[model samples]
Target: MPGTALIVIDMLNTYDHKDAEALVTSVRKALPGIRTLIGRARASDSPVIYVNDNFGQWRSHHGELLQAALAGHHRDLVEPIVPDEDSLFIVKARHSIFFETPLAYLLGQLGIERLVLCGQVTEQCVLYSALDAHIRHFEVIVPPDGLAHIDPALADAALQMMQRNMAATVCATDDITLDATPPVAEPDAAAG
Candidate 1:
């Protein structure tokens, strides 16, 4: 059983969005780190879970998402981090990966207590999902270099908030270690 799972959020993109160009540049910069982390997670025998946006493809599954991304103009950005045969995938429709998704239940089912989150739009989906994971009592780790963002400033602020407010470890990909025992939550200062 894997104690920690690497959650790659919203990376199987078509590169056809309103802010695609800026995002593409960041994705290119972040690609190597993402690849390295994915490879490390696989080598550790931990679960590599790709939780992606459905892209309004209401009838499509993970296979369709992977195919569409591979066929897109930015195949360079999508190919390296594509899910493998042992990878688990879940398609989400909202900003948070847990929104209307079976991810929470799945995490419980898999006995995943800690999550290492990476991928695109650090200010949006990653931030929201970090909050959700925090509230659900799952330890969250964010590797800044492994993430892509449209705005670097917002991304930095989001990382800060995740660390300060959510108790997430805003770390580098090289610093990430999937340990079995998640850090115990601090007692509420106001309660005592």
Candidate 2:
């Protein structure tokens, strides 16, 4: 097992409400799996990195975003789902986590070579992240039930595309196992 990181993308309150309202039906199905994945990642001591969309708040601090989300509309749902102090949070201004973000830099810092990704808007953020990870030569694993998109058809299509074209191993949370070892030694590259 090489050092791998668990990337939970955009599991924010704003998105979850839309997903729950059936505006993004696929997310309803993906939540349970993502939740399970989070649990397993914590148990394995693998870093859990929450890659959140900043929603265009350039000066927005992660703590402020979290506080607002907790105090805002979906307080209850968002609070519990939000990553605790144990996890790391990185805010992004766009779809790709690696774009202008510390995500790539962080992964490099941790010597991560594999990624276990789970989260919202499967066809968009999830797909983009996986593709980026694949292109970066990171081993990508997307558990089938761990991600969702606004459109069910598109979500499924994206998953299939990732598995077929990007060499992402697709499995349900129940069937997948976490690789606990630290990533194998490699040249230290800047994470970003």
lDDT of each: 0.90, 0.79
**Candidate 1 TM-score, true structure as reference:** 0.91
How does model 2 score by TM-score?
Answer: 0.86
Q: Alpha-carbon error at 65 in model 2, in Å?
A: 1.5
Model 2: lDDT to the true structure: 0.79
**Tens-digit lDDT string for candidate 2 (136-166):** 9999998878877677788889999999999
- Model 1 residue 141 lDDT? 93
Model 1 off-target regions past 4 Å?
Answer: 179-192
Candidate 2: segments with Cα more than 4 A from true spot: 16-20, 181-192
Write down the TM-score of every candidate. 0.91, 0.86
Alpha carbon lDDT at 178, candidate 2: 70
Candidate 1, after superposition: displacement of residue 7 in Å?
A: 0.2
Cα miss at 87, model 1 (Å)? 0.3
State in Å the error of residue 162, model 1: 0.4
